[model samples]
Target: MRTVRFSAVAAVTAAALTAVTACTAKSDAEDGTAIQVTAADSTCETSTTTVPAGHVTLKIENKGSKATEVEIVFPDDRIVAEKENIGPGTKYRLTAEVKAGEYEIACRPGMKGHGVRQKLTVTGGTTVKRDPKLDKAVADYRAYVQEQADETLPRVETFAKAIKDGDLEAAKKAYAISRLGWERTEPVAESFGDIDPKVDVRADGLEPGQKWTGWHRLEKALWADKKIGAEEKTLADRLVTDLKDWQKRVGTAEITPTSMANGAKELLDEVATGKVTGEEDRYAHTDLVDFKGNVEGAQKAYELLKPVAAKNDPALAQELDRQFAALDKLLDTYRSDKTSYDFVSYDKVGKDDRKELSDAVNALAEPLSKLAAAVVK
Candidate 1:
């Protein structure tokens, strides 16, 4: 029984608090010695307990006095479970097994404020109940890839138009313009593990004469050292390849709508789990810093999720459409207001950041998540 001081984000009593929906339900366990982690500031309380490696039950109840959540992390660096704002006077549950190792437990009000933390000690356990939902996750991810293949062509055309029309600088900027978007999509790509070689495009890291798969390829072109060249042939080649593939349906030879939606879902999952990286080269952002990474992440979410619209169920489709509308507004506003993003300059973001626009981009993740759940189901 060691008590350690865990630094959690504190909530500002005077600050305005927005209503937050639960990100996921609480996990279950066998010990039943479930402890409730409560927020000293707000009357928010969450059910908690020790996680013994293997199968266990964790009942994270939102005492409903205020919005709250609990995050269960594992030694494997897996965010095994997360229970967010269960609602006042209401509760949500998730049943999951734990694995042996060091773990970090974080229970907070939302992404903004102070919460609670405890170390979960687990030796091991023998329970092998895997959720079938994960299988659907795989299928859902593939569908996302298809969606990207389906939609990126148009954007590629827009990009090509900018390039062919003598906007070489625009062309360079556009190369990795979608790198963040692609990075967001990569996690889902990883889960597929073995993509259909004939259908799924390979981004097998940069190699000689190898074509680029997603947005990062373009980013490479933009940042490459030119050897006395009038134009970046590599960057132009990728655009051409991408645009052509879009037209001819490369990698998407047999993609179903569900698979595409799943892929989009997987990308969003990466963002929530922080599995997504910000940028490859720190200096890469010299041209466009923080804004590009976030903006691209947001844009990729939108671009990759759109096609699945036609394939989603009625309810899911409607939600996706709604999210798209809001996100579109955010992107439009962001583009028009360059002052909002510090991409072109080293200016720090002010209190009135363009996060509204950025959040709009990130927000699509929710609907997309719903869409992914439905697609996988």
Candidate 2:
């Protein structure tokens, strides 16, 4: 299952944008320095709609029954910054950089649909200096994300072609291949606030009245039902079109070093919550393919930030490197063809084998979680 993803922006011009969770939120809110937001099932209230552009802090409390998400988004629904999966009765502090412009404070109840919203106006504010090395990390990470998006389109086309041609076996072969690029850079793809739910939302993740489309929907048709029909053919074409949108929009996505680090951590969370549990590729049993993609994506981000992170906190960086290697080596043990993504079927793995994989993922995830703070410090 896919949870909501947090999105952050890199510094552009004299004003660099980024997001972090602030621990001193109570004091900040008490001092009236942070914007107070109250979220409920159908209502989203903010202390003020206007703020000086620069570093904006939101003190959010979810009073709703379900887990909610809050985002500062552009009018076109591009996420400026967001914090997802805020549980009921929980308070969270979300801090992000903003430029003077029009945006909205969106509260998504149950982490689905466009929930309640309030207008947010950012006024002129002073610019702050940023570390140049962090900027380079952002640039490189952006390019890598774009490269993955560029590569993913053609593979998706191949999968779509197989589905359209009614070649069940061929479609099965193409399914995992097409998803490699997506799984790698899912955070970037998900930043758009709309694409992920359309292209990647699992059956269980769907809300009421939501039409099931994209990979998993088609996966059910191919592997579970064992046949392709008219709806399946139409869905294949839709998948290609949706992914093309992702490819075109990749260049415009917001990127920051912290976001890259956070995204890397999210990938591991995805593995622990979905891939390792055998729930992601439930019908196809190709969870290992996705597991590799998530790890590769996380590692790519970690490598890009290693220089800065090492300088700030050498011990954390070293531990991260060691854990990542351990996890990779453990994963390699399951690969039938070491040169390819040909891992043994997840169903074939024994209970103890699954536990080993789970342990490896958790070991790396613990240290990787600290990467963002190390880089910024």
Candidate 3:
């Protein structure tokens, strides 16, 4: 294709053409002009919607294997008309008219994040631009949702399966993996911070034997530990529902009335899931013990690895730095409040209180060194 040189009006026209891809797509030949926009590096034209609140229908054709999301955003990149096309070569129709205002067209793959952004100018329609902050909330929600679906749910299922199989070793491994996955998603749980994990997730009636530690799995007889009775099933079912809801609602669609509603629904999902989740205090009192152990192990390993870190190796210092940093951050995130601010009382000490601080900081960084050594070839 030739690089089309443009005069002033032509330049504006190309920019406008780029903008035309902004809305949901539909043919309005009988009623008005229909501009077809194929997305980036793909022959799929985006969906376009007519404006000024008329009877309009925007048809989006996503000619790809993966699901695709298209949006008509405001000049400020707020989605105006949005549609999601699922699976390979799926077509979605958005039967809504764009109100008057300035907007742009943006499309992205379903699993992937946002995609190509094109500016769209809807003539004679009300353009309801979005508040930029809403976009951030949607993004944050999406990240959390991905973590829940990709990591949290799978981990939960693994743990449940392990317990169901009555395999102690598998249960143990699942427990640890579940912790990592849960930690990754725990921040979003803050939004639904009221869940009392003990009551919500207890394995009362389930027989001992193996390690049925997580909720939703039974050991031996039918919930013999029916401390919660049938209500437990209700909670478990709610958790599963919440997980699905989170998977669906946490998309980066426009903050339109519908998207706004979806945002609320996502929050609700968090609540439902939170209600059923047995919250293991990541920084539980026992975890402090583990953290301390990991730190010391890291430090000792690093100290040992230092000998292996050839003196001539330029990267040695940096690797040491990186390992220490990760350990420190982990410690900082989970360290007890007592140790975070106060100094450990030493027996024989001088005015060198700095030594105590060094001890504190080192305590956190010790784990990384040990971890590094264990993995070192």
Candidate 4:
């Protein structure tokens, strides 16, 4: 649908920057029970902005000409439920079970700016205890993220040392290997303040007057600028130190099923938005490597929640499996006899091929986005 996705840094940083599945009370409503939210070019109007706290559903209809999205934002700005790329004349049903509290409904028409908003007061629903099975699933994912961090941080130390030692070849080889860990756990990583920007900021994401640093900076020095001097070495060292700090924080971080599902979608969004455009690993032309890592990570996260998703919506889960397999098939075409992908420069991809990749990603993202709400039920 060509959904306009603002960068996560700009769109969601103020919020806790995590997507959480709401523990809404288990209840079924009549077919017409959902509130009708109409998203137009300049306004977001709803049938009713007030509702009982548990198990609220919004039948969001995008009436605007442009692609639009709807978000149910918690008091802390965390997104409890969201539907992206609701193209004109299309409608999507977003359900969430939240505590009795005030929330905001943010509608992004044309996928730009802070979306038009309305106060959504959720009141008078009984509080439901957190589910033990969901908690167990969350803990397992956290452990997986921690394991990835443990493995990745040490390799990054080596990558930084290689750069410091003026071993550009060694550093270049290590670059792809090290990123494997980071991409898998990026959703959880984004929660740790400062670490995400320090470790993975793209040049465009930098604030005015901010010098570029981290992996991309080193990538430019190694491949494009062809100079790995003191400045680049310093950046590499700082990245390693930050990664170590990030590893320490992983154990203490909280992961919810919703966050994991959305994280998977977020990684693919990276592929659809920047990586495919060659904006991410510009110098190295290694966007394919990152793309693969994102897909793997997303796949793993979804797999963890597969049981719950199946229980709630078996058809949706089956469709997701089919879509993932399709995307995986497309990605597999890029591999070569060498351990690494035999990817040409992004500029070299044929238009038809590019469209195919985009289509596959969008296909996966569509069904995948529905998983967050399904599992929480």
Q: Which 10 successive residues of model 1 have the least lDDT summed?
A: 1-10
Which stretches of model 4 miss by more than 4 angstroms?
1-132, 337-348
lDDT of predicted model 2: 0.80
Q: Write down the TM-score for model 3.
A: 0.28
Q: If scored against the real structure, what TM-score would every candidate get?
A: 0.35, 0.82, 0.28, 0.73
Kindly report the root-mean-square deviation of model 4 from the true structure over all alpha carbons. Answer: 6.2
Query: What's the lDDT for all of these models?
Result: 0.42, 0.80, 0.38, 0.73
Clashes of 1: 34
Judge candidate 3 against the unseen true structure and give its global Cα lDDT, from 0 to 1. 0.38
Scored by lDDT, model 1 comes in at 0.42
Displacement of residue 263 (Cα, Å) in model 4 is 2.3
lDDT of 1 by residue, 1-377 (tens): 00111223223342433222222233332332244444432433334334445544444565545555555554322345544434555554333334566665555553223344456665555434434443343355456556655555565556555555656566555444433333434433332222211112323422234334333333444445422133444444455574454434334332333334434444444333321232333224432332344334434443444444345456666766777666545444434364433243213323244345446546766666444334322
Residue 121 in model 3: lDDT: 50
Tell me, by TM-score, which candidate is best. Answer: 2
Candidate 2: tens digits of C-alpha lDDT, residues 1-377: 35433333211221221122212222243212368888887777787767766556678999889888888889777776676767899997665556789998888777766556778888775523457887788899999999999999999999999999999999999999899999998877877877887889888887666688899999999899999999999999999999999999999997776668767887897898789999999999999999999999999999998989999999998999899989988889889766798888888888899999999998998788677657655
Candidate 3 or 4, higher TM-score? Answer: 4
Off by over 4 Å in 3: 1-56, 125-377
Better of 1 and 3 by TM-score: 1
User: At residue 285, what lDDT does model 2 achieve?
Assistant: 91
Candidate 4, 1-377: lDDT as tens digits = 11223334455343322222233333244421356678887778776666775556777888889888787765444556666667899987765555678878778776544567777778775644546766777788888998999999888988899999999899988887788888877766765435666778776666544567778778888988877898988899898888889899888764667667767777787678777777788888888778888888899898888888898889999999999999888887877643564555566677798789889999998888788777766
Q: Where is the poorest 10-residue window by lDDT in model 3? A: 1-10
